[model samples]
Target chain A: MIQRSQLDLRKFVAPEFICGHGALQLAGRYARNFGMRHVLLVTDPGVRAAGWTDAVGESLTEAGISFTIFDAISVNPRSRQVMSGTEVYRAEECNGIVAVGGGSPMDCAKGIGIASSNMRDILAFEGVDRVPVPAPPLICIPTTAGSSADVSQFAIITDDVRKRKIAIISKTLVPDISLLDPEPLTTMSPELTVDTGMDALSHAIEAYVSNASSPMTDVHALEAIRLISSALPAAVREPHNLDLRFSTLLGSLHAGLAFSNASLGAVHAMAHSLGAACDLAHGRCNAMLLEHVIAANYEAAPDRYDQVGAILGAAEGGRGTPAENVAAFRRSLGVTETLAAVGVREDAIRTLARQAYADPCMVTNPRRLTCEDLERIYAYAL
Target chain B: MHMHSDPPDDRDALREKIIGLGETSLHKSYYPELQSRLAELERFRALLDQTHDAIFLIRADTGRLADVNASAVTYLGLSKEELLAMPFASLIAPHQKAAFLETVRKSNEVPSGSRRTCTAYLVSREGREIPMEITVRSVIFGDEQYIVAIARDITDRILTEEELKIKESALESSTNGILIADLTGAIMYANPGFASIFGYEQDGVFMGKNLEAFFATPSVGEEITGHLLDNHTIVKETIGLRSDGSSFHIQVSGSVVQNDAGEPLCIMLIVMDITERILTDQMKRKTYEQLGKNIEQFAIIGDHIRNPLQVIVGYVEMIDDPLAEKILEQSCRINEFVTQLDRGWVESANVRQFLRKHGDGGEPPLQTFIHIGATKEEDP
Candidate 1:
């Protein structure tokens, strides 16, 4: 929707990625290309329990890549976990890393690689371009349908003491290869499937309306919206349908590509603060706040939102506002929840608003937001 | 009431359905995986404790001391348990605590993995202030954010640096011109004295210039280079050319600077302008030569006058007349005067002395008879 003359200079970056029913099988081959004799395998206990970690590990063993499993990572991966993983990597003499799980494991793996190579505390690499060197050879096999950390130049780690999530953005954070296998989605619960599907939807919308969005990113962003809107419901209803799961996985991958290049808007900014403070699921927070952020930014990027509405099957030739269309879509997925229901309190709105306004994602938000505006949004969501 | 009655009978069936969904969502057992990772976590703690620099882990939000390593306990002069129980500010010097806190705040505000350095002082248990260069970075461990500060004591380094600065200042302000040139004769450094000697007001004007350019001729440059190449210190008088194309005599003492391995690194040339000293030496030589010639000439003149006067004295003494005695006395007096001049005693007034000795009067009229141009007669 942005005119050619109005387009600014931009750059795009993404990891080499493969997506299919069994793309997880390629993790070993990619690790071998990096000449990894021994690798540190990063995953959360949840992913390990789901048996995806074993599948990836078996492939590594088949390829003769010996590995040490580091399954201490948690949701919203902590810096301590990253440091602990780095210790394991150094102790085991791992030359490479293979992350198996969702965004949390991938991000934790990136943190481990950075810490191992730089030999510094993981907290030192928090902002854009803060990483001075590339992480060790990393291959990500994402089991979740959302949180495209495998291909993104971003690693969101929770600062437990500060009760916040720190965004570490650098090109070095992007994995060497992202092997996304949709087959893993069949094991996810219906709640997780719905949550991640909405997360993918929010990524597409936010990327499309972001101030940094370019023509290259817009194509992927709009296509992601169409794919997610058409496939998320079916995938949620029938988790074992490989075709529906693969469609959602591809949609999430495209959305990741879009946002990784164009960045995201206030939806991510607010969700990061809310999720960090309240310890909620990242995807659910994004889903709950997407419509409100779109409503606030609709006037600033109306045409961009109109296209998003059209992709989501809004009536009246997509002439209706993006907020209404997104809200309707979210309701269709049975995700009607207020901020209060998600553990956000009226008293904590001020702190959450201040932190959200300070998030790095706020730089790419379509509309300028202040702490007051964010507080009002939080209040409205509640 | 009628609508609710229809659904009441299916409560038991609904519970079973809910239980089945819960069973399906439950994840597999993770206890075995958690047990193995706990050992790795212990290894991580040991690794942190072994670092040489005193390391402190403080909570990013509260500035509480979460952990301290063995080195920190030794450096702070406190036990590990005591150090861990204290606040982060307790280790910082009172005046530096504010700056330390501010640096911690900035480290927290920045993204994880970004490091900031601050030079601050820490208070040891003995109440001594130890200067430390601390590097602070935010790290998340477990579920909490912490600032990992690595502090290194820099007291010795600071003292060494201060001493080096003083020595450097002395060399820069030396009076004798100094130049350091590479093996190929390209000048690398020229102190102020070296610049001023070459009529350059700025020292930088001499940098990167060939040292041979400052010599009066190529041959002089070659002679100095040969001596340096032989690893010998050579001190010689030579001519040096200034920037204005004028040459002056200079005394140069040069030696080759070598590394610990005895390989030549550079040539150091110490030069002093000795033109004035050379001119003074030349003048002294000319004056001495001229004085020697004048003494020789005076001897010849004395021989010629004294020989004739001696003959006159001998002839006048043999004739016993009063006038003959007068002539002998005057001749003897002239001979004495010639003797004085031959002895280089021209400052003595021998004519006045002779007149005063022989004249029959209280005060002889020596002024009336001894008249010379610009020479006033002395009082007798």
Candidate 2:
């Protein structure tokens, strides 16, 4: 939290959300109240196979709302996929959107909403606060405990031609309602659970040390770090434990409230660049790059980083610098690979660093990093 | 932690929104939007009510009136509540109600945008059936199917058509040869009277023929048309040629038919067969000439007898006998009779002039309405 003497100005925005068991069943009633008669149900093939899509569909049917399924989405959603989903949204004459899945489908749902309402290409909105018109009513039923896309005002879509991801940030991108039920998270594989939990931990740590951190954001960020570090390992060991899953879900929601307001740092910026260049999983990319970026930025805001480190528990009696402890925590979760092991070449570090330097998230980073500095960090992680 | 925070700088709208200070940074509440939508719907409803055509919305499944515009109330003379209570099919004419319902059922099965149009009479509150041209289409709103119908009144159009039919019958039944021709003297229409007088069958075969075909001299048709164009009317007795190439005297009275703007549209000619009148006039002329010659001879003979008798009386008077006195008396009597004969001849000339001036008091001379064209009457 900011000192009283240094406190200047800040704001926090959070969407209306409910987290509990059976929370996903309320989507139909909320959609009906929002006057959504016809809905475009956005999901991924994996979530559809997991039966979350069927469960949501049944709810919508019970409320007498007609919906069409749109599951043509990949892990990292492309602009073309968003455009195709928009076409389905229009062809079915849908009035609203209901996303049931992880971050990919939720972010794709946001792109589809704004693209359809504004009648423009999805990439036209690349930077912060570029959306001039609010999207149609979006009700998000999150099937994963991480990504935090359900509560955050951010939509990340990949530009196929450029081979880079663009972030569309606007307060209007926040969903009207989010149903955070832990039952859907049980279907996630152990690897997916660890990768997503590490992502939440990165989010909390980055938001806590960001230059834009305020008293309001610090409270949520530190609590998120504490909850994720304790609950993630047990949730992976017992995938059916509702209590562990709910703790991780709450942690992710709190981290979303923190980073969405305080913005992110070099970790997210570098992860976005690496994911775009290599077509790797977003959570794994963030998990691998988190400790390296913290080591680079620790000197700029050591006291804030120290608070995050103290609350963020380490694995196997880990002790050392805050960066070493975070690395040990990730390795304990079985993400024990360097950048080269994950297919990142040494010659591409310069280009990836340059791309990360241009990311909008760098504006709120605690340390102003140069392209060479980012390249050095990438080499050290490898 | 909030301690040791960096100072904010270079503020912009994007940065403001990132920190949630932008003007539109708020949660997604739909109350204001819903109110705006309802207001727009009210405006549209008002626009529909202002139209002259009666509009109705009927439930496709139940056939009941779901909604109605203000004009529907005015046209049907029923209260809004009463209209909403009844089925849409009951509002149509009794004979067409069954067929209308069938069409509505078919409309529900077709594509939503396609429309079916039919003519029917709308029964009003006073039991008066008014003719209407109705257009109906099926539409889906929410989960319900509805049929939207618009009805336009066609009472004035029907009355106008009936009036035109009566005028057409009058023209067909006229007795005079009423032939309406174009400006170029081409026959546009020749009624039955014209066909019969021209010795042709009334099958309208002569329709495209020129008016010059009926005149004994083709130039006469042109001259009559020119007169009508310049003076607007023509009345004259001219020789007519029939389909069999027979010539007869006929009187043609024609005028130019002008539009409201006074531009000549066509020429209408009323023709009369005056061949019998012409033949009678010719016989009358010959009889009058013969009678004048006989009167001249009779007067001459009377003068011849008077002169001889007077000469004989003068010779008898010189001898101074009784017979001389008697002969003078006889000359005086003969002179009186000769004077009477001269007076009778003068009266006979006056009678001939009177008969020539006036025709027999029947079938008065036909004159074109404008009466501007006239020509000399001849024997043949």
Candidate 3:
């Protein structure tokens, strides 16, 4: 109880509309609610394979909401793709965008909105709260159970020119509605399920302990952690399990809300670097790097780690210190020893570490790590 | 005659003195019993004044402190005079002052023996604070309804209590899913994180929605839960399902939460969602399998090319290293066989792009998701 009386400000901003389980069935109605005469459906091929594209198209057609499909987006959305999407938006005279996939298509849609309404280059809005105008009323229907991009105000686009991933975090980028239909998520391949599920876990953990965390964020973050931790593995092993898939979807949504406000830490920082340099799966890279970053963060606040350990039920009163807790945590996650096993080479460690240090996510890390320390972490990871 | 007159007067005076002496003797006989009774009263008074705990004598007229013992001054940090002048309500913490005053008002109706006590913080002379356990009673002292309060310092004890509370809160708000359950999988305690994981409110008042609700595959859950029960410890990466029908894959490490009796009151489960690592592991396994199949297919292709090439090499070796003059005479035929075989092998083997890509400077094209039939058909 300090006399200074630090007032804690709390905020919760979710998508205005959340139709969780069978939400996609009402896609047209929701799209119409946005008052768009013509809707542009932006998605990737994998989503098309899952047959969600046709369902969305049919729903819109049945409801008499006019729509055009743009399915050129890939796993990592590119500036060229956004430009092309913008062209499609203009040619079709599509008044709104319904991004119906994981993060990439939605991110591209946001980029398209930026390019169409305001700017020539997508990279110009490549940081926090940079985009000035609200994106064209976008409704996000996530076909995957990961990447809370639908509700998040952030968009990540790849810059082929620089061979780097650019993040556009603008409050105006938030979607008008997020429809998480478990039907589409059940089609996720086991690998996709695992990768995306890990991404959600990373989001939850990072937000739960972020420097900018508030009690409100902490509540959501902790809930996300609990639900994701309990449900992700099951979802991965049995994608068709409606119960598990639904829980994960809800959990991921909460996690997205949390991290959007609280932000993330070094795991994301390092993962972004890996995504840029190696083009590895973001979730896989995060999982690979999570423990090492946890170990590094251990020294910053051992007491917090102990509390976290106790909360995880990994530590008892008579148990060992924070080091033991961290080790136990990694072991529990079933994470392996090094980045070497993940095809990352020793020679690339220095470059990756330097890039990781430059990542925006590193700003809120509890520990102020030096370039040398990050390099050592990369070496240890290897 | 004169001796008789003096003796009579002396006799009369001696009788009056003797009567007074008898009266004094009777008073002296009862003195020891009175002395013993006075000694007992003084001893009781000393015991009350010298006690370690605070003793308060309250006035019925004003409900204020009439007198406080030496210990009261030390415990409450108030001088005897100040304590005697101040109302009991003044000693209470600001937040609790009204509550204490209300309780005192209610105690007025209650009988003296039925007077109650509670834990409270008392203010001191130096403005320092100390928590105390105080007992008050209604007593008749000199025809007034006076209250006696006995209080003791509990500062250290209160600090310990505060520490425990902080620890409990920390555990409750932890980010990790923590569950302390019995061997029967009946949950004894769950942190807010744990409750949220299974899609239950941290303070949800619902029963029958325990650890069983989280297991996506009930059979696996039962197996692991049973294992933890029997073994007192189990740690594994497994899957859980939430109430909303979504699943989570987690790594669970559990240990026995035991009671003082040494019997397991509960098992604490520390669950981590390793869905990311598991997915990567699955990917690695799939890739390894794919790599194996590719390698084996390449081996068959290798043998087909190597067999004829090896025969041609055998023939060439005979021409290059002939054993004798007779063997050397066969060199021309060997030369013809080698040249024909080399030409046939080279001509028949097509330059497969898969092999060429690996052998040439170009790297293998990375696997990416591409939509089939997505490209528009261009007219010639």
What residue runs in model 1 are displaced by over 4 Å at the alpha carbon? Answer: A1-7, A314-320, B1-380
Taking chain B only, the TM-score of every model is 0.68, 0.68, 0.56
Worst 10 residues of 1 chain A by lDDT: A312-321
DockQ for every prediction shown:
0.01, 0.06, 0.00
Per-model i-RMS: 15.1, 8.4, 52.3
The models' CA-based lDDT, in order, is: 0.83, 0.86, 0.72
Off by over 4 Å in 2: A1-6, A314-316, B1-28, B35-380
Instruction: List the candidates ranked by lDDT, beginning with the highest.
Output: 2, 1, 3
Listed for each candidate, the true contacts retained, as a fraction, are 0.00, 0.08, 0.00
**What clash pairs does model 2 have?**
A1-B1, A1-B2, A2-B2, A3-B2
Minimal lDDT window, size 10, model 3 chain A: A1-10
Task: Write the residue-wise lDDT of candidate 3 on B1-380 in tens digits.
Answer: 24554456567566744553211212112223543565687787678768888888878678788887778877766678888788887888888777766666666669876677877778876777678887777778666888777887777888898999998988877877877766677666777787676676644432334566677777765677788768878888778887678887888888877779878776778877667767766665565446445544544554465566557656666674556444445654554554455444333233323443444333222221011011101201
DockQ of 1: 0.01
Tens-digit lDDT track of model 1 for A1-382: 3344445898999876767767788677667666678989999898899999999999899888999999998888888888999999999988889999888999999999999989998889988889997787788988878898888898999986788999999998888778878888889998888888888888888888888988888888888888899888899898999999999999999999999999988999899999999888899999889888888888888888878877775522334567878887887888899999877789999999999998899998888888898999889899
Q: lDDT by residue for model 2 over B169-264, one digit each (tens)?
A: 887787768899999999889889888888988739877888889999999999999999999999999999988999999999999999999999
The regions of model 3 sitting more than 4 angstroms off are: A1-6, A307-337, B1-380
Candidate maximizing TM-score: 2
